[model samples]
Target: MTDNSAERRREKQPRTGAEQPWEPEDLVISEGKDPTPERLEEARRRLADEGPSAIERSAP
Candidate 1:
């Protein structure tokens, strides 16, 4: 059997808060597609209004 305690610890660790403010790049509109200016602006607004949770809500 393999010792997997370290991996488990990493997985169980709470996520750290954002070190920097959200940027347009942080908004992933799609996997491979690039975001348009309008989408980026929308994301920016959402980030301002909703905080980090906007990222998850923006993408599919």
Candidate 2:
């Protein structure tokens, strides 16, 4: 039979550390974060108005 004790031991070992969660301070619109609804609307408006110039009328 194949030996499996090492694998079990490895699984039993305690974790060296836990990963810290990312927490950006500016997770709001007032702080000038990107990807807001305002940014999307502006992009659509630009596409309709400008008609595809590889650029847009507005972006965040």
Candidate 3:
């Protein structure tokens, strides 16, 4: 069998930081509820103003 342990280890490693810049889509406004346009816009604005902290601030 091919040894894939290294790949598995890499996958299990914690991310050093965000792979890409935060986007409005990254926000989780509610559990089952889909975010509205206004909420998305708010997330966009928050991302611009607060950076990644916006995600924490907007989390349910």
Candidate 4:
């Protein structure tokens, strides 16, 4: 190997799909609700503003 830091940096770059995929349980289901785009937006908004606990509270 050459004594070049730039070449080492390029070699250590992440591959595709290096992270774990979510399971079915990763999806939070609410009663009488479908997993639609609107719901997804709302969840995202809640999560962004107030985080996971607020999302759980506001979801159902």
* Tens digit of per-residue lDDT, candidate 3, span 4-57: 999999999876344447667667442234678877887778778888666654
Instruction: Give the per-residue lDDT digits (tens) of candidate 2, residues 1-60.
Output: 999999999899764321222122222232355756766565456445554331311112
Q: lDDT per residue, candidate 1, 1-60, as tens digits?
A: 999999999899765434346687567443234787877787678788888666555455
Root-mean-square deviation per candidate = 6.5, 14.4, 5.8, 9.3
In model 2, the runs with Cα more than 4 Å from the true position are: 1-33, 54-60
User: Taking the candidates one at a time, how many backbone clashes does each contain?
Assistant: 0, 0, 0, 0
Model 3 earns a TM-score of 0.49
Spell out the clash pairs found in candidate 2. Answer: none
Q: Model 2, 45: alpha-carbon shift in Å? A: 0.3
Cα deviation at 58, candidate 4, in Å, is 5.3
* Winner on TM-score (2 vs 3): 3
Ranking by TM-score: 1, 3, 4, 2
* Clash count (model 4, backbone only): 0
User: In terms of lDDT, which candidate is stronger, 1 or 4?
Assistant: 1
Q: Give the lDDT of residue 4 in candidate 2.
A: 100
Candidate order by decreasing lDDT: 1, 3, 4, 2
**Considering summed lDDT, which 10 consecutive residues are worst modelled in model 4?**
17-26
Badly placed stretches (over 4 Å) of model 3 are 1-19, 29-33, 58-60
